[model samples]
Target chain A: MTGSRRQRVAKAVFLHAAALVVVFLMAFPLYGLLLTSLQPESVIRSRELSIIPQTLYFEHFRAVLAEGHIVPLRRALVNSTTVSALTAVLCLLVGLPAAYALSRLRVPGRNVILGALVSVYFLPTTIFLIPMFVLLVRWGIDDTVFSLVLAYTGFILPFVIWILKTFIDRLPLQIEEAARIDGCSHWQVMIRIVLPMARPGVLAAFVFAFILSWVEFLTPLIFTSSLRMTTVALGMFRSTIDIQVGQQAAAAVLTLLPVALLMLVCQRLITQVLMSGADK
Target chain B: MQAVPDSPAIGGQDEWTRAPGTLRRRETAFSLSLVAPALILVAGIYLYPAVYTLILSFARFDMAALEIGRWVGLGNYKALFANAAFVDAIWRTIYFGLLIAVGATVSGFLIALLLNEEFYGRTLLRVVVVLPWAVPPVVAGVLWGQMFHADVGFVNALLFRIGLIENYRIWFGDGRTALHIIALAEVWKAIPFMVLFMLAGLQSLPPQLHEAAAVDGATAWQRFRHIVFPLMLPIIIPLMLIQFVWAMKAFDTIFVLTRGGPAGQTTTLNYFVYVEGFQSFDMGRASAAAYSLLVVTLGVVLMVTVLRRYAALRKATA
Candidate 1:
């Protein structure tokens, strides 16, 4: 018994050591990015690399925020936020009803429609970019934030519908029936009964759509030319080409912040949703 | 038909019944009202653009020719097939998809298995694992690019310090290494997402199965093979297929890292389409290429769905 216990303790120690290695490997690049962003440009260009900053230079952050061609950065952030928020709202506006129909009402061709939407979720958005660009140019909205939002909605709606539909399907149908018997109309049942119950799912869908739009790069990179319409991702690309490492890192950190916060805030729900989505 | 006294039909409600006409009408209206907005938005934004791209593929709509261009039928597609660069890109994309999907899925599953253990600071470790995914793909690409820099990159710095290399090597200056490096970047950036999903799958699994296996004196490898692997397959297969499709369309990472550089060695099909459309302004050819990619992606999706259905049927029968 003692021998077996010792063996178990040895295995535990080995497992813990392995876990520590994994954590270090995963976090090292980010730590390096943070440290590099804090170092002055002259120190960064020096022959010898310093693992730790000798003196903290917060000026890099100020320079990134104040000095460089920040107009594009500012515009990109605004555009990204606007496009992402609009996409989320639009997705909810359209998807909630479709999900309700799928969940509650027996519509003709419902199964086929659901299957088609799910398939479209797997389809590559890049495939549609070329023709979408042409159509946008023809309609004179190619480079506009409006086009970006539209594209984001189209790209994201299928996933949103799928997620919401699953959640709605799991809801107790008897409650809606009770509401109806209480003399509530179908719309009333949806607004008063179903919507409140599916709040978590809706939040999940909104966060998903928002992140997708915010991080999207291809559509904007191909369609837009004006600096005013660039996204944070595109802004990072421009900064990299301009060799502004500090600004690039800062932008990278900023872009990551909101999504990280959202994930932490809704960790359990997001985890469940993401797992279901991946599990098919 | 006799009215059934407030008894709503449970299963087979006829649409044209006179007794339930009011109920039927209300249901129809509700259904239409619920679905109309989504249908319109999806059809207008998604379906129309896809169809329009198909049509553009068959036409010779160059900018110089403008609206005066003639329909060339399958000429654009034919030209794409004949173009060596395009063909090469398709092969590269397939290779890239296979490499990164397999790499990310396997490594991610391993990491998930590790993280699933009851260890101290597990939450902090989870955060660390997911950090790469939180960083925007563009930023991740730039970070990797910086790391691979020959003169000042941390990668080279570490290697030189460890005496593994006599001098810093130009990692991105060569075609062969450039594609692999970009693939590595994609794998690193995307593995965290795969791990998150796989970890969820692992956690959802019943621990009693492992306990029972252990009681039966099964070795660790045997337990993993006989119990864990089979249980996880349901989630693993679908995630693998989706990851494959996503990798095929990977662009931002490659774009920021190499810009499909070192003489177009790292250019996947998606990057090829972007270059053709925006850089060369060859809308006709780009649309054709994009259509082909769309067809392939759709084909893969269909295959995955059919596979999932088949698995479900088998499980039901068993």
Candidate 2:
């Protein structure tokens, strides 16, 4: 008993230690990134080997927020937020029933539609990379925020639907059945029964789509050129070459701030999304 | 002639409709109506690009260079085959994919195994572990770029301080190390996702099996090898394949980090298409290159999947 007890304690120590190392490796670069954001560019350029910042600075953040900079951080924030929010709303509006139907309907060609939907995931974005530019240019929406939003919503639809459909499929069909027996119409069954039970799923899909959009680069990179509709992603990329290290790091921080906060708030739902997607 | 079976699938029991014998038709209409928005969006965004690829691949369009389309079918494909840069880009893409897939999957497996235990701060660590995943690719790339900077970069400073090297070595300079660093950043971005998938697989495995194996005098390694390995293979294989697909097609990280630079060391097939179309304005050749890449990627994925299935069959027979 004593030997087993000692071994169990040893195992626990190893587990905790391993977790610490994993956390450190994952968080160190990000910590260094945030460190640069908090410090002046001069200190970073001094080549000192300090991982922690000695003094906190806000000038870089200010410069990013300043009106006349090339990146235009404020416009970018608004543009990114608008695109992300609109993408989320648009995806949910379109994805809810597409997911529902895929999960629960007996429609003809169900498999074909579902199979086609997976094209985005399986194929390289480059297949559409060149052609999409031409297509968008031809559509006369090139370089507009609308073009970015439209492309992102479409790009993220397949994953969003897969997640939401998994959520909806897990719902007990008995209540839906009971609603029908109680003289409920199809709309009532969905609106009253499915919708009520699908709040968490809806939130999950929304947040997932929102994050995917917020982080998306290809659409903004290819879709928008001018600074008027620049996302922080594009701004961050542009800043890499044009801006100082501290300011670019600050931009990275600002871009990641909301995503990190949302992850904390939607921790369980996000985990559920990943796990559910994995299960399928 | 055959009666349709009543389905609780969707569209409530057919009672409020006038068409008594049109149950299938009604269900189809209702499903189609519900899915109309998505269909339209997908059609607009997905179908158009896909269909347009076919036409553009055949026609010559370098309008920016004052060239016009001549509808030379197969000419673009022939040119693509002869293009060394395109071939190099494809190989580089595969090389990057292989490295990232192996690195992320292995690290993810270890982390998932570690996290599967009952421990303190498990939930907190789970959230922290997924922080990298939540990071947007371009930002993540930039964060890494900051780390890899030669003058003030933390990577060099840390290595020098630790006496790993005589001086700070450029992490992203030469063509050789550029792709490796890109792979490293990608591994950082991808590990969380792979961990999530592996954790799901881990949690789904019944603890009873492990317990029974333990009580039957199996060592830990033996128990894992005989029980966990086979069960986890399915999950691991598919997740790894997905990771491979993402790494093979990934552009933003490479674009932001090196822009396929240091003499085009990191120029993936995706990057090649981007340059040809946007930089050179050769939409025809770019389209052809992209189409070829798509076929090869799909073919590789299918081949791997079939090979895995075959191996599984052979092991069972043996």
Candidate 3:
């Protein structure tokens, strides 16, 4: 018995060691970037990259702030937050009902419509990018945050609808029926019974929508032409592409912050979505 | 995992049990109202322009053609198919996509298999695994670009020290290496998402099958081959399909890293569309190429669906 117990412990140790190696491999790139953010340009240029830079200091962060990263970041944070929050809110407003209809109320051709909606997004976003640019230009909303919001709402709505449908499918229709029997109006029953039950899913939908838009790169890239108008993600990209090394590294860190925080806060919920299965 | 919002004990009991009266009609109207805004939004923003892209493809809609909106009747598509560069771009897109699909599947399988074990520091390991999934694709590109840059590159330095090379190998300089390097970055960025789906599938698996197989003197490989793989197909198939499409559409990593450089060797269909339409102002041809990409995606999806159905049918019969 003791001999097998030793083998069991050995197996556990081996498992842990292998897992640690994987964790290190996965985390190493970002950690390397963080270390790069601290190093001076000269040391960074020496071509001897280490886990921790030899001449590490806080100067890069200071330099990044001194450059235009801080101001644009402020605007971008506000812009990203507002657009994402609004996207989430708009998605919820429109998505909840569609989801409810699909899940509960017998809307004719609902399955076909839902399937079509999903398949539409499966086509490359580029399929829409060119025409969208033309459309937005004609509408005169090009280079504006409103256009970004509308574009994001359109893109994220289907995902929100899909997720909300999953949630609403799992919800009890009897409560809503009970509310209807109790003389509550349809919208009222939705608000009072179904919506209350779906709060967590709604929040998950909102948070994920926010994160996706917050980190969105391409739409903002073409849609918003100017630096002043673009997102933090765009700023980070420009900082890197333009070879603003110190600022680029710093901006990389800044770009990661909101997403990291969101993941930290919402990972449990996110994993639940993952755990539930990706089929629908 | 967040508790699933309380489900009523009643199974599949729906809201239509009341009556087939005027009240039901009112409910239908309300439900239709509820779904109308989404339909409108989808139709206006998504559906409209997609069809417009079809129109724009067929018509001469370049700067000069923008004025006339003249119909060209397969002129753009003919040009696209005739262009060797565009045709080549199609092959490059599939090459990169297959690389990513295979990489993501293998690494995701490994990570899932590892995490499925009862290991110490499991939560911490999970966080580390998921860290990349949280990264903005742009940031991931930038970060990896820094590591792979010719001078001051970590890849070169480490490779040299480990005796993998005698000199610094410029990872992104050669056309041959650049595309694969970019694909590698994409694979790294994609691992977390793949692992998430895989872990979900892995966790849902029943361990009793493995235990019983082991007791029957089956080797580990046999058990996995004969049991785990078949049971895991439902989850892995959808995840891999999604991964294929995503990798095909992926633009950020390669764009940031190479911008389809070294004589446009790394350019894919997605990039082809962006450059042709936005950069070159050849709206008509770009639209044609974009539609071709869409067609390829649809064709793949259709093929895979049929294949999976056939496999399932065969298995059932067997």
Candidate 4:
């Protein structure tokens, strides 16, 4: 008995120490980024590295907001928001019906479709960028936000449908059957009965789709050119290359802050969605 | 048994056949309507582009041609095979992929195991572990790039301050160290994802088994090796396979940090395709390279999926 107790205590101590080290390693880079961002320009550029900032400078944030370098920061924010929102809506608009059919219809080729969709998850966006760019040019939508949105929808729709289909599969079928028995049309059953029942799944899909679009770099990098369509992720790149470390840090923080906050707010939902056997 | 219900003279026969047929038609219409938008988007965006790329691989297409190209069957593939740069790029890509995938999976599994225990501030620690994943790839790449900068980077500065090095090292500028540095960046960015997946797997393990092993006087190492390791294989194998594929296709961090710099030491197959297609405007060769990547990725996926299924079957039988 004594030996067992000792073993348990040893395990606990070991785990705690390991966890502490891991936590520090995980947070260290962000801490470094923050420290560098807040330090004075001279201090940041100094040869000696300091773990802590000598002096905090809030002015960097102000300066970044004021300088309006490359593309204006506000424009990037709006562009990201608009593109992400549209992408989310488009994913739902396209994913919902397909998910429904996959879940409920017992349709032929459903398994094949599911497999095809899952394969899309593995496709590297970089390989598609050139062809997609050419296609966008051919369609006369290159360098436009529309093309980005379309690309995002195409990229995310498969995974969204897969996830939503799993969620819908778990839902009880009696509700839809009852609605059908009441002389309701298939559309009515979907909108009134099934959708309301699958609200969490829908919301989960929307959040994932939106976050992905918001944080996406390659598509926007290759597809869009002008300030009007520049996303925050691309905007950060454009601004950072000019040696605006402070402003770039601030922009990075801003771009990352909302998604972090959203994840925290929806932590449970996000965790559930992630942990579910749906493809990443 | 219900033959009496066939009262066709009373208008029942027409109603029976017509109603069933109409229902079938309605079901078909509903299914198609529900699927049309998704199909159209997938076909137009993904399928069309993928097919077009395959077709372009066979042609002598260039930017000057502006979408009008002559057929040059096998020319591009031949050139890609003959080109030393492309060969070197493919070799580097595979090396980088293996390094990152194995490194991330092992490190992540260790971290997950440590985090799985009851500990102080476990929740906060979990959140911290997720931080690397939350940061966008571009941000992560840039952050690492800035950190490794020769003069201003904190890494060299810290090393020099600690008297570990006499001179500042140019980490990203050297061909030998550049790919390794990029690999490290890839591993750092990907480790969190591996941890998240592995953590979920770890959490699902039964505590009773561990207790039983302990009661049987199994040493900690033995318990892990004999019990936990075997059970976790089902999850770990799949995770490793998926991560391997992801590593093979990794591009963003490399692009942001290295751009296959220092004489293309870090250029992966994906980057090679990007440059050939976008930079050089050599669509034909790029397409061939892209198809090569697709074939390799598909082969890996097929092999892993089979391995996973076999493992699953063995588990069931056992």
Q: How much of the real interface does each model capture, measured as fnat? A: 0.48, 0.68, 0.62, 0.43
- Candidate 3 regions exceeding 4 Å error are A1-10, A53-56, A67-71, A238-241, A277-280, B1-19, B64-68, B309-318
Query: For model 2, how does the per-residue alpha-carbon lDDT over B1-318 read when each residue is reduced to its tens digit?
Result: 111233643334455454654756766688788888898998887788777877889999856443346898999999887878778887888888888988999999999988788899988788778889878888789888988888788778878888887977777779878888889999999998888878888999999999999899999899889999889998888788888888877888889888889888889888888888777788888888888878777777898899998998999999
Give candidate 1 misplaced runs (Cα > 4 Å): A67-71, A239-241, A276-280, B1-18, B64-68, B295-318
User: Worst lDDT window (10 residues) for model 3 chain A?
Assistant: A236-245
Q: Write the per-residue lDDT of candidate 3 for residues B4-105, one digit (tens) a residue.
A: 343221212344464546445665687789999999998878888798888889977746424327789999999999999999998888778878888898
By TM-score: ranked, best first: 2, 3, 4, 1
TM-score of each: 0.90, 0.94, 0.92, 0.91
Better of 1 and 4 by DockQ: 1
lDDT (Cα, 0-100) at B231 in candidate 4 = 82
TM-score of 2: 0.94
Per-residue lDDT, model 2, residue A68, is 78
Best by DockQ: 2
Give the lowest summed-lDDT range of ten residues in model 4 chain B.
B1-10
Mark the regions of model 2 whose C-alpha exceeds 4 Å error after superposition.
Answer: A1-10, A239-241, B1-19, B62-68
Two-chain DockQ for model 3: 0.51
Give the TM-score of chain B in candidate 1.
Answer: 0.87
- Give DockQ: model 1: 0.47
Count of backbone collisions in candidate 1: 0
List of clashing residue pairs for candidate 1: none
Model number with the top lDDT: 2
